[model samples]
Target: MTDGLEGARERRVRTGEGVELCVAELGDPAHPTVVLLHGYPDSKEVWAPVARRLRDRFHVVLYDVRGCGRSSAPKPLRGGFTLEKLTDDFLTVLDAVSPDAPVHLVGHDWGSVQGWEFVTVRRTEGRIASFTSMSGPSLDHFGHWIKKRLARPTPRRIAQLLGQGAKSWYVYALHTPVLPELAWKGPLGKSWPRILRKLEKVPAGAYPTPSLPTDAAHGAWLYRDNIRSRLRRPRDDCYAHAPVQLITPTEDAFLSEQLYDELELWAPQLTRHTLPAKHWVPRTRPDQLAVWISEFATASEPDAAGVPAQLAAPRTGRYAERFGGQLVLVTGAASGIGRATAFAFAEAGARIVVVDRDAEGAARTAEMARLVGAPDAWPETVDVGDGQAMEKLAARTAAEHGVVDVLVNNAGTGVTGDFMDTSVEDWQRTLDVNLWGVIHGCRTFGRQMAERGQGGHIVNTASAIAFQPTRALPAYATSKAAVLMLSECLRAELAGQGIGVSAICPGVVNTNITATTRFVGTDEEEEKRHQDRTTRLYGLRNYPPEKVADAVLRAVIRNEAVVPVTPEAHGARLLSRLSPRVVRALARVRPRV
Candidate 1:
C-alpha cells in the first residue's frame, strides 16, 4: 500500500467464482461512496494520489481487480480475465461496501473500459449513480465506430482508422502467446517505471508496486479474452443508464480522440473534458482529476437538480470548445485589459481568478465573471511586484482553487520621461511592476504547471513600445522591452514541456492607465497637465481594451510567441522587422503635449 492510504480500512471481498479481492476504504462510510477502479497492470495503489484528495469530501473506495495486486488470480489464467468475470468482481465489491446506496464510479484506462460496461448493462442500472471515464473506450462502442467507418469508406474516416491502428500496436503484441508474459515478468517490468518517467513525465515514486510483474502477466489476458469477441459483434443496446463524464487526455499514446466522435449517440447526457496530459492521469494529474471528479459526482447527486440544469444548457461562446472547464487567472483584473480578458474567458465557461492590488475591484471583477457564465470565480489581492506575497498567493490559489490552467501576467504601471530626466525611483518602480511582476507570476505559477506535467498557457502583457522605440517614454519602454525578451526566452525553455508563453503587445488602448501614469522630471502642475493630455489623446484614439483581451485568448489558442493587438501595433511590428530606418524616424518625433 502507498503512504497516502496508510490508515485506510481493509476488507476481503470474495466473488462467487472463488476470486478474493482486496478493498480499501477511506473517509466517512455514511458519506456518498465514490468507487475508484484501477486500470490493467496497475493495483489500487495507483489511485493513492486521487484517493487522498477525494477522501476528505466523500467516502472513497479502491480495490485491486482480481489477479492484479493483493487480489488472488483465478485457477486458470487463460479465460479468467474476461469482462463477464470482471463485472462479477465489481458487483461483489459493491455489495460488500455500499450495499444500500449507489456509488459514483471513477475509472482510468482499463478501469474506464470496465466502467463503460457497468454503466451500460441492465443488471447494474440502479447500482451506479454516475460514471467518469478517462483514457479508455468501450469495446462495444469502438466496434461500432470501426464498422461505420469501414462501411462508409470515407478518406478522412479511413485515415483515422489507420492512425488508431498504428497506436494499437501494443495491443496486438499483448495478445501474442507467452512472449508478453515473459517480457512483463522479466526486463520489461523492471524498466517500466523508468519508461513512464522519461516518456510520460510521471514523477518517480512508490507506485507500480512490487506485484507489477505478476499483474502485467495476468493482465495480457484482459485483451485476449475480450478484444476480438466484442469488436466483432458489439452490443446494439449498450447505451449508458447514468450521466457520463468523459475526460480525454489529449496526449494519450494508446487511444485516438477521434474514437469518441459518435459517443453522443451512445450517451445522451455526456459531458466532455479535455486535458493536456498523457495516459496515466491518476498519478500525473491527480489534483485536477480530483477537482473534476468532485464537481461531476456532486452534480450527479439527486439533490443537485440545479447542477445538471446549468450544465445541460449549451455554451454559445466561440472559445468554449477549447476553454470550457479550464481555470484562468488574470492579474490587474480590476479594470482595463485585464478585466476584459477575465470576462472573455468567463463567457467560455472557464473558472476565473481575478487578481489585483485593489481588493474591492478584484472582487467586483470576479462577481461579474460569475454572472457572465463562469462556473466558479474568485478574487485575490496581491501586488505582483511583491515576491513573497505573490508566492503565498500562488500557493493559496493552488490549494484552494486548483492549479491555474491559464495565467495572464497583466499587472503593470506606466512611467513616461526622457532617459536623463527619469529618476532612479521612477525606473525602479516601473521595472518592478512591469518586468519583475511578470517574472514573479511566471516563476510561481508556471512552476506549478510544469510540476503537474499538464500543458498550460502564460500570457505576458508587454507593449507595442517594446519593439517601436519611443524618445519620450524611456522607463516604460525599457520595462516592456524586458518583458518581451523574458517571454521569448521562457517560451523557448517551456516549449518542450507544453507550456506556451505569449507576449501581448498593444498600441494605445483607451483605459485608466494614462490617468495614473507618472511623468518624471516635472513639477506637480506640469505632471498633472501631462497626465490629462496623454489620457485625452488615448481617449480620442478609442481603442477598446476588449480587443486586446480577445488577442490574449487567440494567442493562447495559437501558442503564438508575440501578438500585436491593434492596427498601430501591427504596423509598428512590421516596420521593426522590415524597415528599421522608418521606425527610427517615427521614434524621433516629439509627443503632441
Candidate 2:
C-alpha cells in the first residue's frame, strides 16, 4: 500500500497558454473521470488527498484553475480574465487532457465560483457531465443577497460598511496605476500566505492589516475588473444547463453562506451539503470531500457516451421516490395537445388539474388523466381567457394543494381564416387566450410562487407557428409569437428568483384543435368540412401529448428555458434564427387550407 498512499500520482502538463499545471491524478483512468478546480491563493496540492482517496474508482484529476500555485500568471489583457475567457481556459485544459470525453467536475472557492458561473451559462454546461460547487453562489444571487443583508438601518449598515471598507483596501490597490510593478518587485516576495490570512481574518473582525506594498494592487485590479464586468452583464447571456451539487463550509470566516440562499435559481435539481470546516476544504477535509465527489461522479450519467447501468440508475431516497406526489396544473387540458399533456403529467405520478373552458370535456379529460395513473386528479372549468377567472383558479389551487410547483400554460385557440377575414374581436380573442392567458398565469401565480420562496417551474405552450407566421392565421400566429417573446423575458426576470420559465414550441400534435378554431362558418357542416380540409392539408399526424408532457418535466428539472417538442418545431426555430427571409417566404407562399 506504500504506507497508506500507494495510489497517488502526479505530473506536469503545459496548457495552450504555455503555463504548466502540476496535474495530480488518482484512481483508475478506466473509471469515470472527475475533474477538480482549485481557487486562488492555493494550488493543485490542495486536492492531493482527495485525488488519492477517489483514485481507486474514479479517474480524479486536480489542477489549479489558473494563475495560482505551481501555474503561470500571464499579464492581463483587455479581454483577459473575463468569465468567458476563464471558462475557455477551463475548456482548453479539459480538451487537451480529456479530449475524447466529458467529465464530472468539482470546484472550490474561486474555482467554485467559476464552476457556478459555468453551469448557469448555456455555452459552457453542454461539455460538463455534472458539476459540484463548494462555497460558491450564483453570482447574481450573491450580489442581491449581499446588498439586501447589508442594506438595513443602523447596526447592519455599520457592519456592512466596515466589511466593505476592509475588502476595499485590496479592491482599491488593484485600481492604482503602479500596484502591479510594486507587488512583483517589492521585498514582500512570496508573501501570498500572509496576504491571504490577513484578508481572511479581517472580514470576520479577527485581524489587523499587515505591512504590504501597494504593488500588490495588480492582482487586486484583476479581481476588481472581473467583478465589474460581470456585474455589468447578467449571467443569462451565458447560463448553461447542467445538474449541480453545492457544498458549503460552516466556518469559512470570509464570505457569508447567505450567498447560496437561492441556488436553485441556477440549477433546479441542485443538491447541497454543508460541512464543518474552513475555506481550505480541499486541504482540511480532502477525504470527506473526495467521498462526496466520487458519489456524484458515479451518480451522473453521460448522455452522449455509454454510462454504466449501475451509475445511470443510482437509487433515490424514500423521499425522492414520491416525485409524482406533486400537483401539476395544465391549462387547455381538454382535447388534442392539452388532453395528451394532462395524461403525460399524470403518468409521472403528479395529480392533474385538467383546466379548460369546456366543462364536460375537461371532466372527461380529468377522468382519463386518472386512468393514465396520476396519483389523484380533478377538473376545473375556467376560461383561461378570463383574467379574473385565472386569478381565482390559481389562488384556489394554491390554497387547496398547498403549492403548485409545476404550471403548464397550455390552453390556446387558433383560427385558420385569412387575415382579411379576421375581425377585431377575432384578433383580440386570439390574443386573449394565446398571449394574455400565459401572462395572467405567470403574473398571478408567479408572484405567489416567488413569495413562497420555493423552486417552481412554469412551461408556457407556444407553437411552431410562433417561429414563423402565416397570412392565413395572422392573429393566431402573432399572438403565439408574442407569447414566445414573453416567455423569454420572464425566464430572464425570474432566473435569480428561483422561478424557471420554459417556452414550449410544439409542431402539429394530433389533437382536435382544428374543430375548435373560431372560423367564419355559416353552419356546422361547413365548419366540419373546413376543419377536415385544414387537417388534411397540414398533413397533421396525431403525436401523443405524453411526449411533450415528459419533455416539460425534464425541462423543469434541467432548468431549460426552451422546449421544442417536435422535429418540425426545431426546424422552424432553426429557420427563424438562421434564415428568416427563407422562413418568411415559405410562410407567405403556403396557400390557405
Best by TM-score: 1
Q: Pick the lDDT winner.
A: 1
User: How do the predictions measure up, each by TM-score?
Assistant: 0.93, 0.47
Q: Which segments of model 2 are wrong by more than 4 Å?
A: 1-322, 521-526, 536-540
What shift in Å separates residue 542 of candidate 2 from its native position after superposition? 3.3
lDDT of 2 at 552: 72
Candidate 2 all-Cα RMSD:
19.8
Worst 10 residues of 2 by lDDT: 202-211
The clash count of every prediction, one per candidate, is: 0, 15
Worst 10 residues of 1 by lDDT: 304-313
lDDT of candidate 2 over 1-593, digit per residue (tens) = 12123454656666565655555566777777888876643455556556666677878777654455444554654344556666767777677557777778888866777777776666665567788888655555555545655556577655765664564464455556665547644645456545444432212111111212222332344465576556444445434466677777766665555556666765666666665446666654554476557666767756445542233332232222223445678888888777877776776555678899999989999998778666567899998888999889988986554457678898998776777778888888888899888998888888876665444789999988888867767888888888889999999999876788998888887666776787753366877788887666545565766677677777877878888988899999999999989988987774645
Instruction: Return the lDDT, model 1, position 581.
Output: 95
After superposition, candidate 1 runs with Cα above 4 Å error:
304-311, 395-403
lDDT of all predictions: 0.90, 0.67
